[model samples]
Target: MRIRLTDVAKGRRDEALPPTSLAYASGEARLALAETEQRPTVLGLIASGRMAPDVGTVTIDGRADAATLRRAVALVDAPDVCDPAPNVTVAGMVAEELMFAGRPSNPVSARRWLEAEGFGAIARTPVADVSPRERVALLLGLTALRPGVEGMVLVSPDRHGGHPAEWWELAESFADRGFAMLVVAGEAAAIVLEGRAPRADAAAGTGTAAEELDDLVAGSGGETPAALDSDLVDDSEAEPATATAGDVAADPAARDGSAPASAAEPAPEPAPAPTTDPAPARSGEHDPIPESADPDPTPEPDDRDEPEGDR
Candidate 1:
C-alpha cells in the first residue's frame, strides 16, 4: 500500500535505512524500517501492478476492479471483499473474489480452494458476522491458493498476523506452489521477510517525510498522525523517577506548549496529619489549669474524705 504521509513527525532523522529497493516501494515499507515510536499513516495509494517508474504509472492488482488507485496491496482491499447487503453469502463473496481474479469458477472447486486455506467452515457465514482479521486472513489464503498469480503483493500483513512463522509458512507453501510474494509490515521485521521477492529497501526517506509532517503538525498548526515516538517518552526505560524538573525545564525547543518549572521553583510540601490521641470536649467557657501556662498539665486527684473530716 502506498500511503502519503502528512506533517506530524519531525524528529526521526536518527532512523535506519534498509538494504533493498522494493522495500521502499510497497508503501508501508518505510514505516517498517523506522525504529522510532513516532510515525504517521500517510501511506499513499498502493500501485501493485508493477513498479513502472517511467510510465508514471503504478498499477495495483490488489485493488477492487481498478476504479481507484488508493487500495492497499496485500490483503488491503480484502477486508471489504464481501458486500454489506444480504445479496451474497460469505462463502459466495470469497468465491466471487476468486472468480473475479480469474480463479476457479464452480462452487465445488472454490470450496476446495477455501478448504485448503482454512476457510471452509466460515464460507456460508454472513460477511457482517466475520471478524476483521478473518476476512483479511481469507484473502491472504486466497492469494496463496490462486494459481498463475506469479507474484503477490502484501500490504501491512503484520497487522493481521502476529507471529512471523504463521505467515512465513503460507508464503513458503505458496512459493512451492510457484507464487512470488511481497509483504508490507509495520516494522522492518526481517523474520516476516523470509519468502518475499527480489526485495526492495523499506523507503528510509518515507520515515523522513512522516517525521517532517509530524514535526510540522506538532509545532505550528495542522492535523497529522499523533507522534508515536514522542508518546514513547513515558516508558520506564526512557523516564526515571529522579528526573528533576530542571531537565524538563531546560529545553524550550522541545516544549511545544508551556515549559515546565525549573528546580528553583518552590515545591508544595505535604500536609501533616492529626495525631492519634483524642482531644477533650468543650467545657463551660474557658477551661484552663489555674496558674498554668503550659499546654500539658497534670490533673489532681479528688479528696472527698479529707474535705468531710475538715468540715
Candidate 2:
C-alpha cells in the first residue's frame, strides 16, 4: 500500500499549513516537516483522511478515496484530538485503546497487557509522565492493533522532547513489519534525521535512501519549513522580544508615533531663588532665625513683669 499527498495544504495562503507533498509506501517510514502544534495536527488529519485539504489531494494506491484512506491509516496522538488525557494512568490509557481495538479493557487485562509489552512498571504512572520513546512506542503499538490499520501518521512526537532517533528507529521497526509509517515533526527533528540519514545510507551502502531523505527535506524547504518556525516557538519557553525602558530610550524607532516628551511638553519654571541666605550658626546653639524669614513679625515685649494696668 502506498499513500501519496500531492501539494496538499490547509488554511489560507501561508497560514496553518502550506502545500506539502510526500509519499510513503508499505514497509517504509517517511518523515515530513510540519512545525507548530497546529500544523502537525492539520497535516496528520489531512493525510489520514480525517480532514479535507483546502488544496491538492491525498491518494492511497493512486485512488482518492477518503473512506478507504481513513480505514487504512491511523492518526496517532494528535493534540486535542486522539491523544490520551494527560492525567490518565498508563494502564487506563492502554485499556481504553484496547477497547478501541475490540479487545479486553479491564484493569487486570490492561496490567497484563502492559506487562507483556514491557511497560508494567509504569502501569500506574500518568500518561503525561511516560518517557517520550515509551509513549510513542505504546501509542503506535496500540494504533497498529486496531483492525484495518495498515499505516500510521504520528503527529509531533518530537514535542514530547527526546532525541529524534529513538522514535524514528521505532517507526522504522514498525515499517519493517509491513506498516506504512509517517512522522510529522518540526525542523529540529528534520535536521537531526537528515544528518543521520547520510550516515545510515553509508552504513547500509544504499545511496538511494540518502538521496530520497534529502529530497524530502528539500521539498519541505531549506533552513525552515514553509510554516514560520517563529510561530512554532513555545510562548512559555521563550518570552516575546519587547522594547525595555532603556531600549525605548536608546532607540528612537522604538518609540510610539507620539512626539518625544521634551518636544511635546513645556519645561518647568526655575525653582524660586532663595529669599534670604540661611542664618549663620552660633557655636553650641540652635539658630534663632528661621532659614526663610517671615515677611512681617510681631515683636514680643521684654520678659518684664509689667503691671496689668499701671496706674
Candidate 3:
C-alpha cells in the first residue's frame, strides 16, 4: 500500500519521456493511458524490479529499491508484460505466476485455491477458453494470492468485456482489501474513484505537455476538410453513359439550338415498357376435370330376393 511516483519519467532514451508522473496513495485507483508501445514498458518497469523511473522517485511505503518494490507490486494479465501462454491451463498459469513471484508454486495448491474461488469449473480448461473478462478477473485474483503482494497495476483491463466502469469497480474492490490499485489503459475510462470523478489534475495523458499523442495514435495529423455536396453525389446519378457525337446532335435541344453551351446534355431517361396481359388458358390444358363419384347413369331397382314366385 501507499505507492507514490514523484515526477517519474520512463521510456526509451532515444524517445521522449512518458507522461507517467504523479503521486498515488493506497485505497485510490488511478487510470494511466499510455501509448500502445510504451504502455507495456511503463507497467512492466513498475511491476517488475528491472527499471526505475528516470526523472523522479518511485516509493512504496518509503522504499525505492527495485527488489523491494518488485516484491510489493504485482502486474495482472498483461500480455505485453507477462501473460500465460494461450495453451496454458488456468491452474498452470497460477502455478507459473506464483513460482515467479517467489511464492508457493504447487499446482495442486493452485488448483484448490482456484476451486475455492469458484473457478473449479474452468480449473482444467485452457486459459484461451476463458472469456476476456473472466480471464482478467482470474488473473487479478491470482495476483492477490501472491505472497507479500501489496499493490497491483492492471494494464488495459478494459480490453476485456463489460463497461470500463465495471473494470474500475473491480480495481476499487482490490483497494478496499488494503491493496494499492492502479489501472492503465488506452483511454480514460469513465470511473467514479473514491466516491468522486477522476480529478482533472490526476490525468497524466500518454502524451507530453507540448504534444497530444492521441492525435498521432488516432491517425489525425491535422484538421480534416469537410466533404462538399458535389463530392458526395450518388453513384447512380453520376454514372450516366457519355453521349455519342451523333446522339448529341440528335438531341431535341440541339436540333432547336437551345441546348446549353456544354456539349453534354443529360441523357433522356428510357421510357417505361408497356405491360401485356397473360393469355387465357384453354379449358382442358394439363389438368383433368373432376368427375362425379357415381358412374351409373341409369340403375334398375333391385327386386326383393325373398320372393322367387313373385319374380
TM-score of each: 0.36, 0.63, 0.55
2 or 3: which has the higher TM-score?
2
lDDT of 2 at 246: 93
List, residue by residue over 188-269, the lDDT tens digit for candidate 1.
4554454543234433333464554444454434554356445545564665445346755776743556555556568998
Q: Name the candidate that leads on TM-score.
A: 2
Candidate 3: misplaced stretches above 4 Å? Answer: 12-17, 47-49, 98-107, 188-311
Report the C-alpha lDDT of model 2 over 217-238, residue by residue, as the tens digit. 4445434444434444665257
lDDT of every predicted structure (CA atoms): 0.44, 0.79, 0.62
| lDDT (Cα, tens digit) per residue for candidate 3, span 141-214 | 87787788787777766565556666777777887888777776654353433344353126433324223222
Lowest summed lDDT across 10 adjacent residues in model 3 is found at 209-218
Q: Judging by lDDT against the true structure, name the best candidate.
A: 2
Give per-model CA RMSD: 21.1, 22.6, 28.5
lDDT of 2: 0.79
Q: How far is candidate 2 from the true structure (C-alpha RMSD, Å)?
A: 22.6
Query: Sorted by lDDT, highest first, which candidate order results?
Result: 2, 3, 1
Ten contiguous residues minimizing lDDT sum, candidate 1: 36-45
Residue 220 CA error for candidate 1 (Å)? Answer: 51
Candidate that beats the other on TM-score, 1 or 2, i.e. the better one: 2
